[model samples]
Target: METLRLQTFMVFMLSSCGFVLSFQINHLLYTQSNPTAPQTLDRNDASSILNSNFDSSLPVKFIIHGYRESGNSEWALKMKDELLVHAPMNVIVVDWQDGSSGWYFTCSANTAQVGEDTHLLISHLQTQTGLSLNNVHLIGFSLGAQVAGNTGKRNPSIARISGLDPAGPDFSGKGASDRLDPTDAQFVDVLHTDGEPLWQGGFGYYEPCGHVDFYPNGGTRQPGCGLVGEICHHMRAPAYYTESINSDCPFTAYPCTLGQESCSTCNGNCGFMGFHADKSQANEVFYVETNSESPYCRG
Candidate 1:
């Protein structure tokens, strides 16, 4: 029976989702501080996969990668490091580098199954570690953001989810069930750093979809990003989030009043964004500006 289950796991890992494509989907999963030594969990081995503790009392953070990137990417590792420095918690990175490569549309289409399969993987881990679902936080970047959204859909009891500039390509203008929306979890916060309309080289969703949607620097073109390469603008979302993890100054946001969606002004009470954010200020839009370099917090 054990051998049969292992064979089944292998078949699932090497098969494509549902786009008439069949290629090996290797998931280089990491549940440790070091990315160089990631354990492939699909082999049905859990006792030896992680050398750390998954305390049920503490929160679990899953940091996912974006297009053409893997768990070994700088952003993934940087965020993991920052989180560990801030708190002693469980951090896992989902590496779908094999499935997320190739054509853009193909990769976009693969997120649906990725979310489903990842949810199953997390569920399996929970059973082993006796972890609570309420203590899980999903922080997904770009396409991974959408995957996190779908994961929330798969398991609706998650405490909170942070969509770091969810990819706008196949998800924009989609319904709440189709893309990242407020109902996906108990609290959902989104950061928009590259919301330029799709017609204008935008890499992120332009609309406010989360409970608290933060638009830093007008949420269009970032301050230091070049005029031509929009990737830098999109990448700023995770950078700012990483800095917010351990910075002396937090990323505070100003509320936007009625009919003031695009206003660069601040009104009413303000709240901090990212890891230290308050969930009480949900269903609102926030705006803030940052410096051109490290310690981007203006305050």
Candidate 2:
């Protein structure tokens, strides 16, 4: 299985040999004052953050998109909206669509620079606005999740990182320094939605790579995504996380041994999944079930 996966990864990289290109990373800030019209943030310009509506007192949330997606994508925007509704925050959408839309390998390679750029932006924000790194939370999906990991690796003081189905290709068996792992942030939580082998049509890493990992519906395929296939399963990570922002039903998850089926009981070892996941539940793996449609939490 390992050999087959490695061979598949090699083929993917070789297929994109001539597609590498420079990256253009952008940070678009949205506050309660300007929720729709995002102000562009530049790490090179201190005034970009100082002149904007960013509130240093508010917790900051950075939303990052993955391969072939932009910060302005519907899902990213929706998540920003949900987060604002939940609480006042300095929301920045990291936009790297130009780099993200190319061949998969090129996009994957671009994540390192994105992470560095983000770290620079955060450092600039702190220097200019007295923004506390402890108040910063990174929420990244797919390749963006790996980007988040990279940033956290550089800035380990970051408070929390929520990885939504981190990409598997070229990163599945990489060292912790090369991919998302528990050491990336003070607290890292991951939701695995498409963890089956690539040959089997999965798009996400299968092993636990966070302080706490949530495997919803076994983490390979999700309910209600039967017709749409792997993409649907992968996308469910963000969908479920967005709904969790203000979900009336708690995404209650119970600790379970890896590969154990029917491990549903709380047994005094449960934690809410998604946005409200408890930081105290570190180094554990949990499982939860969801509904077939929206408002997926089963409480």
lDDT (CA) per prediction: 0.77, 0.89
Backbone steric clashes in candidate 2, count: 0
Residues 1-299, candidate 2: write the lDDT tens digits: 55665566455444543465676889999988898999999988888888999988899999999988998888999999998899889999999998888778789999998999999999998888999989999999999999999999999999999999999887998999999988988999999988987766678988999999999998888998873233789999999999999989989999988766546887788998899998888989999899989889888
What TM-score do all the candidates reach, one by one?
Answer: 0.85, 0.93
Q: What tens-digit string does per-residue lDDT give for candidate 1 at 58-149? A: 67788888877888889988898888777767677888787676666778777887788778877876777777888889999999999888
Residue 59 of model 2, lDDT score: 98
Which number leads on TM-score?
Answer: 2
Off by over 4 Å in 1: 1-36, 48-53, 257-268
